[model samples]
Target: MKNFIHTFHKKLQLLAAILILSGVLVSFTYEINTSPDPKKDKVLVGVLRYILKNGHYEPKDVNDDFSKAVYTKFIDEMDPVKRYFIKSDIEEFSQYKYKIDDQLKREDLSFYNLVMERFYQRLEESSTYYKEILAQPFDFEKKEQIKMNYDELDFAKNKNELIDSWRKQMKFNVLNRIQVQLEIEEDKVKEDSTYVKRDFATIEIEAREKTLENINDFYERITELDHTDWFSTFVNCMVEQFDPHTTYFAPRIKEQFDINISGKIEGIGARLQEKNDYTKIVELISGGPAWKQGDLEVGDIILKVAQKDEEPVDIVGMRLDDAIKLIKGKKGTEVILTVKKVDNSIQKITIVRDVVELEETFVKSSIAIKDGKKYGIINLPKFYIDFENPDGRNSGSDMEKEIEALKKENIEGLLIDLRNNGGGSLKTAIEIGGLFIDKGPIVQVKYRGNSPSVKKDTDSDMQWDGSLVILVNELSASASEILAAAMQDYKRAVIIGSNQTYGKGTVQNVIPLNKYYNYPDDLGAVKLTIQKFYRINGGSTQLEGVHSDIAMPDKYSYVEIGERDLKNPLAWDKIEKANYEEMDFYKNFDQVVNTSKERISNSEEFTKINEYAIWLKQAQENNSFSLNFEKYIEEEKEHQAEIDRFKDVFKHESNLEFQSPLKELDLVKKDSSLAAKREAWHKNLKKDIYIDEALKVLSELEPKNNKLLAKK
Candidate 1:
């Protein structure tokens, strides 16, 4: 479920701000005369005057040219594509611009008819082209086969064909989904209902009629679907548009926006992305049905979906919204998906839908020993915890359990592996940070027109008072930033890994607009940027993410990645600091820092990473590589040599048999051999220079208390 806000209220707020700034003695009034051309120039002037007086713009002149400039600017900002109106459409729209003198008014039927007619034509064309493509077997040989080469195609023909194809495919997909749902519902009624008032014939007839009605409803509502790709093209052709951020949400799209913001819904619990005409799996939630089944994997293509014991419906070329509806069902119902694997093999999987609890996203850990030293390795897949379900076990709680297990093992130091962690619950972040430090504010949230709220680590007990090191990369974000920032702020632990974190300091409010309003179908939701997070010292983790205390060589260089490269991202800012005491362990951090630097310089893994980085930089700059058969073979051989050089260090065993680390036979002897093997293995794992450095750092910083106890 998502929180819904009124769209009308949002608009009113803007309008109120404008009115306040104008300071008009009397309310300005003008009547818009209905005409074929509403005098676009006049409307442009009125809008510019209002904006200059009230909006952010402060114009020096108030003339017709100025009005045109404002109108042009609005058009450019609002619509980048000229698609909504071709030259003729623009000319048609310009006829009635004069009607904008007083209140904003337009001939609703005329404007709607113009847009609707164009949309219908596009739909019809899309339907026709889709049918033609469906008539032939889909070719899967080419990875980019579904891509539309618009530049190469005849403009008019291509546009019409593409539109028709899309429409037909969407219609077919919608019809198929309705039929499946109806059948599934019908079966449930037969099984659960006690009363047998109606015969099988009546039930069958009613289900058929219901399915038909659904199909008709979808067809009629096609106009409401604000497919942004189509609108983007339309707006681009119009002229100068506004910032790309400002976009209109169609009724259907509103539902999608809602689902996106909430992050949890009654679906298969899989992350999906649109690739050409297909919805590809970006990632599988660790404990979700897909992951549990072990059939569906990352990069797998969803081809179709089916109801239990029913014919599988092909979903290729179907809209993502429609596909999602088919997959999402009431909890405990089974939905089968037909998936095309990366290996070009196809399989059908049936999943019993359930509430996608966020706790499932976290991975817990224990300890591993090599020689006499205890190594605490907590493998965190993501920083996830479900705030909506307070009673549910969260990532923080799971981590606490792992720490308890490590404490029992008498671990000397800890390794918090945050590799590939995308982040999750903010609440869990604060709680986890509490485990490191005694007490203090963990993170701050700043919202529009509101004082910043400080989230503190209020927990009384510290889980681990020993040495700690956090592992991170470019992928770590949101809650990951929160935990890493807190640890750095308190000087409680050493931050090691990539140059910087993924700077996503803002928080979004997922408002479900449809939940507040009644409509034929789900209206969707909006994910609005309502708040930004700041560190305790006031420095924001915006474009500049948390910088690690000690930097090491990473496969991905700082030059190629991080938040600075992102567009339209919020800028970093600072605020007043809160009171806190720094940890004593970090007082001599410079000594530890210098020692690690010197060690890395002498490290073979670091040297290899530096070489690899140089090679990558050269390749990117040159952009010219040998394609000649002989040269290509030679280049490949050279690449193999680099791989071979690093392979010798790990002493990697190809036919290595699995052994239970839990076995208790001559533990010290078993540990000594494993430790020797790992040291040798470390030399080969050059690709992960950060991990190599982390291990070395841990060895140097090994708790003196544990060492002294062992000697005694």
Candidate 2:
């Protein structure tokens, strides 16, 4: 057994912590050796416990309360919809509710064993129930309602009750599909005078059959999960008690987490998912080798995979992860895939594997021209970076290049869209924020009991000092919050969008499990919350994230989707404010904000969005649907009518023209896929009401030409 002890250098500490903390812990690892291994699970539990208790920012006591929380989380996760386990099964499992804490200290697996064995039995029975229910016809005339809120529902009292629940759920599913099919038929008949539409009976039967296939495929995928996968879930349930961000990654999951943080992977760059007994291609990375080949496409099913000049191995009935192993290879290596095309034709497509950078994950800039003044819009998906390779492509460097390109275009203003960016590399956030201002403190970091350390922009150079506006939403978090907060604190940029960003202010560090224990099996690492983030203004973006300078109404405005909505998030606090000089570039920032507010108040589009937000909130709360076909269709018709009122939100187009930079124009023109993506992005920007308002705000500021300071 090789010991994998990962020691972080002093300079790489901040980078490593942010890379793991910013993103969600990814999927489970592929099991190469699929035999029952209880010993590995036991060791993992011990190692995970040790790491959390010692390394966590706020470690909870492993007492009765902790045990109860874990017990509930584990069971809820395993049977979220209350479809598998019954009331009696939960009753039997409740005995370990308090014993789990003691079991963890002793590295006991009794609770996990009992639950898994019961779960498997229940899973098998549920599969049988679904198959039986779907095999027969469903009565659409049945006057009943299925509660969509699964949390409020209870487990079945008996076998018969469970079967009844499955029947009702299955009927609801079939009814939805039938309604959709009927709509398609109605549209087809209107579009073509001679088009023959399917009858009610035919549509109902087809919907049931499709529902059966979907359920069967779902069960097939579920059956592929082994012990390691479930154990990871159980471990995470325990670890999450420390905080929501702290999670466990299985060995393969850890590898994937690294790939996500880096924003690039070496493979064919095609995302695959299992469909019953086949591997279905879901998406092709825009600039990947598979996309460049032009032979492969989405919806293609891989029947077999082969190495260069080698006989193809059938991949039918193979696990998705296993099939991925066969498809992915080193850069410049060839992998031949015998795929069934969407047109039902079979063809062998050979693609040379190469490092595929996910285009959307990196920083991409587009220029919007209005009144002959160019404005730059840089959308940063995440604070991505490759921790293992210091010289690898990162968001910091990419943003720098993008700013330079936009500067060459002589943009009058800039809009940095950090909305929905959940953050990644901490180093990149600092690097990117520095581009907007001269050397100053950007954010503050503090350990559990240590003095707050100020993280600053040591560089004296500024890449962009024009009229800047940051776009954020409730989904923007961590490094996104850091950058926006710094800009807001310095009064260098106008923060616009949601009322407040996603309040994830904690910092986490990934600790490899194999480092502490030399084991043959590749035990995954744990992302532990080791620190908290504080803005330069002293307020921590924990439960209360960076408040927007000009709040806008959107679909998610009334949603509880921030850190405060999450379980056991760290509390918000304040520290000593960092010493930084506020920029006076936008002297009338308040005037610009007031003008935008007035415009928004009078705009019909903003009024519609606000009304839609209220409607969405009501829709989310009303979680019951009628099982009766007539009643269901009636309810859906009302919803469709309400949705129609907001159609202009999606269809609204602005007069501003958007296009790629001069340097990217040639590259995009060469890569048709790239061109299509940019074109789509430009079209969306043209329809963005927020961008239109932002451009107006930019024009109002009329920043001086000498906002850029002299480089030291």
Candidate 3:
């Protein structure tokens, strides 16, 4: 057995206190040959606990109180929907809840092992519950409702109660599938008026069969998991108490994280979100396999996945991450997806997995004509940079080049679209922010022990000082927030978006765990929050992201989708303002914004968007659902009607046209994929209500004798 005992370089007094506090210095060692592999995991746990204790920016005391907190988090994470583990299970596990902290300090696995055994046993028992309930068709006439938010309900008292709970959940799924099947039949009858409709019992039986398949697939996958899997979950539950972003990634997870950072993923390249036991496609990376296939779409529910020549594996009710793993595979491999489309029609689509280039993530420029004059749009997806080679392709330098090209066209104004941009490199944010002003402090960084350092853009050259508008949304975060805040603070640009951006102010550095200790295999990595960034004006964008100057009514404006929605988020604060000059670039900015607001009030698109926002809020709060099939179908129709009321809002298109860069036009013309993507993007841009309002605001931003200064 090998043990890792890192030599501490702490002060004698601190070391003495740590020893006294811990009582006994216990070290865990892993044998060369072991089945459970507690030795390696114990080392990982030890390393993380030490780092949290000694090196974390805001370390917490690891005692009984912390242990209790971790226990709650683990239980919640293990079964978020409260599907498994009855009341007795909780009582059985209560003995080790407070002892977890002491056990962790001593490298003990008693608590973890006991919890794991109980959880697996409960899951095994619940498997039978689901199968038995699903085998029998649900009673459609029963007037009952299932509480969707399981947190509001207590655990089942006995096996019978647990079976009833699973029964209701299965009934809900069965009702939805039957409703969808009936809707399809109705549509076909509408087309032909002679199509035969299946009886209710037949539909019911098919739905039950599908439910059985989903449960069987779920349990089969669960059986594939090993000790490493559960250990990762437990350790992360412990680490996440410090902050939401600070996470402990297992070796496989760390690899995925690296893949994400590289902006390249070997898969179909579709972003998936789990809602109500179904995995729905949110976004497809342009030019990726799914995008190229053109059959897959956003809002498509992927119900089943199959590899080439293999039977389809049901993904319905499976965890989103697990479902994704089944869908994603090695490059050139084919995966078939059975999806239920938005219109309730089922279809099968096959796509070959490949390393998606994410071409759309790069800085893209287009010319927009509002009257006879041309305006420029620089849509920056992420502040990407090649950190290995600083001088390589990066947002800072690439944006400068894009501006120079736009200047050659003599654009009347410039609009930077940061919507859906979750942020990337910090250095690029400062550089991009510097492009507007001659030179200034862009942001401030506060470390644990060191004083706040002002990250300044020292370049004296200004790229574009013309009319500027920065577009953001609830998803716009970190670097996006920094750039928007800097521009807003300097009075250089009008920030417009949902009510605020995603308020993630903290900075993280991913440390490889193996680097700290010797290990034969990969030991994963720890992403630690070491610092928090602040605006040059001194306010931190922690929870309250930068408020838009012109608050636009968007879909997520009313939802709690920002960093504040996360657990253990850092608190917002302010530091000493950095020394910087504020240019009076938009003296009439307020007036222009007010006029736009008035127009927005009168505009159909804006009004409809606001209505949709209200509807979204109602939908989020409407958790409980009717288990009776008739009521459920009627409720779905009402929901669809409400959506239909606002359907025309998204279809509203501006008359303006977007132009491709002259140099790339020929290349784009030759590449069918690029041409198709550009066409699709231009179509969306025309339909963008926020962009329409942005353009209107730009037209209104006509300066009082060059108030839109051209700084030299």
A best-first ranking of the candidates according to their lDDT comes to 2, 3, 1
Better of 2 and 3 by TM-score: 3
Off by over 4 Å in 1: 1-269, 275-282, 287-317, 322-363, 382-392, 512-524, 550-567, 591-692, 702-712
Per-model lDDT: 0.54, 0.79, 0.79
What ranges in model 2 sit over 4 Å off? 1-35, 191-196, 255-367, 384-394, 397-411, 658-681, 702-712
lDDT of 2 by residue, 362-396 (tens): 78999999998788999887788988998998999
Clashes of 2: 0
Q: For candidate 1, lDDT tens digit of each residue in 1-712?
A: 0111133234434543332211112222222222333343223223323332332111123334433443343333322322222344445544433322222222123432344455454344333343333222211121221223322322233454545434433333333333334445677788889633443223323333333333333333443444333332232221112211222343345545645322233567777765445777755665566655556755578887888888665565455666678888877888888786543334567888876655445554434443456667676777666667878768788888778766766767787877556677887788888987768899998776568889998877778877788888766777888888888887777888777887878765544444444444433333345577888877888777788777776545534445566433566888877667666653346677789988877877666776665554453343233322234335546755655554444232222111212322245366775444334433333334455567556656643333322633
Worst 10 residues of 3 by lDDT: 1-10
Candidate 2 to truth, TM: 0.78
**Model 3: residues with Cα > 4 Å off, grouped in runs:** 1-35, 190-194, 259-267, 272-313, 317-322, 325-355, 389-391, 519-521, 665-673, 702-712
Best by TM-score: 3
Per-prediction TM-score: 0.55, 0.78, 0.86
RMSD of 1: 17.6
